[model samples]
Target: MTDTERLRRWRLVLGGDDDGTGATLTGDDARMDAALYKLYGSRPGGRGGRRGAGLGDSAPSVARWLGDVRTYFPTPVVRVMQRDAIERLDLTRLLLEPEMLDAVEPDVHLVGTLLSLHRLLPDRARESARAVVARVVADLERRLAQRTRSALGGALDRTARTPRPRRPAEIDWGATIRANLRHYLPEHNTVIPERLVAYGRRQQAIKRDVILAVDQSGSMAASLVYASVFGAVLASLRSLRTSLVVFDTSVVDLTPDLHDPVELLFGARLGGGTDINRAVAYCASLVDRPDDTILVLVSDLYEGGVRDELLQRIARLTASGVTVIALLALSDEGTPAYDTENAAALAALGVPAFACTPDRFPDLMAAAIEHRDLTPFTNHNT
Candidate 1:
């Protein structure tokens, strides 16, 4: 690599520390250094000596620092730095302030923090928090909405196919040809289909019920954001009944807010003890047809509720033909901190438990809707 590239990498690694590395930053690099220093540099003490620095006590100073990071770095890098500030400087409580809320860039992690702090936020700051959550929700919707809709819609269409056709319009030519490809005659060089496959007529009634039972513990903030967005997308389909239920110790049904993910997210209460069995029982009550329901539980499986009851409930759901899935997390942060015992117990009951990224979720849902083996998707991601 070039010397400039090496310097940039070392600058990022060293952060705001000046350890006599014999490297000098100029131009844009110098500006980057200034931004980093604002967040991580040491400050001069009142007695004219050096003191440990931080985000400072002033809200506006932190706000301006937020803006400087955004201006100096790309969106992804800004998100990482913002997350680091929250951790290193203990800035999560400050996020409840309206001015602080306005200054920071919106992302899944930020939304997670806001949701966790929702109950403690003052009335005046609640609106600002909602706005920040809304911005992140809108961005995720723009990026994932179309892909999710297309994947699930295709799955629904595929599942609607039948072997018997009443008219030519209903025939699935591609499926028919593939099903009979082994019957090709060498002389004629053409395949003859002994049976026909046809698309079922569009149903005016609901065909499937999707229940997203999300764990809202403080660690599950990212999963909550992704689940809310997906709930909204699934609810938009005419042939599916979608419901979103968020739980910590208590369960709150946010299905009513599925049309607006922002509102759904705001309705959630993050950070509390988890009760997987209680939440699963509540989700079970929503299932009118166990054979046609998809229950996706997004949690780390750190069950604070009854353990035996949770395992039994999952066993019952699977026995009743309910397609139950346990997602350890739903972000790109890779394998999350999860309870391996609970995960393995669920696996023993014939339910696949794994961590899925946001990009793979649509495909996972489609696979579940079609009752296909989830090992391919799960194994690949895990």
Candidate 2:
């Protein structure tokens, strides 16, 4: 394909807008360039030239297009499409082959590529094809961790200087009065202590516990991705303790791999019959203080387990002081066809069944940390 043909195809893909003079792609050209930059910026030669097919006359550009094809095309044709695109560019940069490797490693390399393809993905593909996001985040986590300690060390220092509140103490006033007797002036007046203040602030150590119970049934892929990311974040916090449990028929504690989110996600069984009740019971047992622990159940509420037992377990967890959050999902799409009847039943038990969005999760964690009531998201019963 000539550069002009490539430019024409790209224009068609981006929904070309007609400029009166027709000298340039304009409007949509700018938009497509921005999108292309986002997909290719990590590579060299990603910057410059918002117009012209020659803008993409580079090895990295062809590599990125190959990456895009691998992400957008079905499993069968991805490799063929990538090879053809690489041949068309005929560039010898390392990115060409790396891009092919990036495409073929379905579970590892497709995440960032898919994230770039988000705008183009259809509904069915959006849910089904996003399983690779966990792998991407795992890769990202490794890269971030390398420089994180040095970058965050100063921030940690600022936090360490903050004053903490003191707790009420049981005390004897006699010793307090004796210590203050010198100020009382023994010659003229005797002073009684109005109230006793502790010599120093005694701050109680607060330990936060987060229990993430993820439902790993086939369609709940997005929820699994979000759960893995959040579990890793909670694990990194100094004050919080996080346990990540993924389940379908049985619960497996992936907490030990929290430091490596990808490992935790890979350790999970992604598709199977869901026994939500069994998972909840297992999660309840793993937590020490029900009140101090935040139990986040991410599922569609589809169950192979007994419904009555599941509701009872949720109730028990809440009544025991565990801040139970029954999330039908943790995705950009709030909730999809969930079990409404089961959701309502759990809500009645004070379980707060609601759909949680990924962006609102940090606030949810804050509420959990403070042991405060979480303002539930849209309630889609069922």
Candidate 3:
């Protein structure tokens, strides 16, 4: 009937724990409440602080109040809750956010929290995380912008490594030069043969490219948040080509809309049937050179379309030399709900499927770049 009542229903629908006595909620009411709670909670209480007494014997009312606010919580309120949860829960400490970040650099949401935590972190630890964040951001942007070179422009490409590009710039100069060396030689009578001479005057164009193909099904919202930030980073790369695709039964190319991560996320329809086959084929069409591209498929591997076709398409891409890595997720959570049968099928095709937090993306990219063998399933390692 009301926004509060609607949110309660949707929460239960989302597999949230609810007492199960509520009025029915239409889609409009649920959306409105979600917006409202995102803006402001129904009841007033900062995270971790105790509510005043007489609320309830078991805090049911308190939870109810929070749920009522959940749908219509304000953006500022939601942000505070996010901040508070990070603080009070001490999730960073428990999850080893700092160390995990060092091992695998995550996106802005994680970086922002760590930045907040940086105040309390030891100097060395904080510095290390910052450095990792800096590198990770740069690397991630490159991955996001797979082929749209010059997005950030000449300043990044022409710049040398001494001072380094900040936030989102990591160009592989040696690789680029070596890749284009044949063109540099004079046609008439030039025999440039020694590794020493080639190394002596090597100035390569360092460019970054990233392609983010995400599944927009219901179970992927948290991972979607990280994906949006990563999209923003990829959009920042001047030398790399970047594109974002969010799919349900249908696929939509959101590459032209990477300016705002929030908008990019809203562009996605979070819950729907999956067509991994169609999504992959669509992404394959976008790839100019599979060898130069890194295709990250963030999905549970469920196929609503033809399953055999999906596996065959993936095998084709891998054979074409595309760096196809399967990520079950990019959330703080270990592994969200996924499709085991689909994962197994793709694994058989040699597609590397793993459940990874955003923190591990940087190392994962590095490994992908080095052409190292990637493990196909996330659960196997654990």
Which is the winner by lDDT between candidate 1 and candidate 3?
1
Residue 28 deviation, candidate 1, in Å?
3.3
**What TM value does model 1 have?**
0.91
What ranges in model 1 sit over 4 Å off?
1-12, 15-20, 42-50, 182-193
Q: Which stretches of candidate 2 lie over 4 Å from their true place?
A: 1-101, 104-135, 138-206, 376-382
Candidate 3, run of 10 with poorest lDDT: 193-202
Error of 2 at 215 (Å): 0.5
Local accuracy of candidate 2 as per-residue lDDT tens digits, 313-335: 77777888888888888776534
lDDT tens per residue, model 3, 107-210 = 44555445334546665566566664555456555554443223233323333333232332343446445655675667654434222211211243334346
Clashes of 2: 6
Model 1, 1-382: lDDT tens digits are 9977777668654753454355777887787777776555653532123256566776687898888788889999999989988887788778878899989989999888888888899998999988888888899999998999999888888888888888888898899999998997989988898988886746557778999999999999999999999899999998789999999988989999999898788888888799999999999899879989999999999999999999998899989999999999988888899999999999999888999999999999999998889999878977
Candidate 1: the clashing residue pairs are none
- Give all candidates' CA lDDT scores: 0.87, 0.61, 0.59
In the predicted model 2, the residue pairs found to clash are: 290-321, 290-322, 338-382, 339-382, 340-381, 340-382
Number of the top candidate by TM-score? 1
Candidate 3 Cα lDDT to native? 0.59
Minimum summed lDDT over a 10-residue window in model 2 is located at 156-165
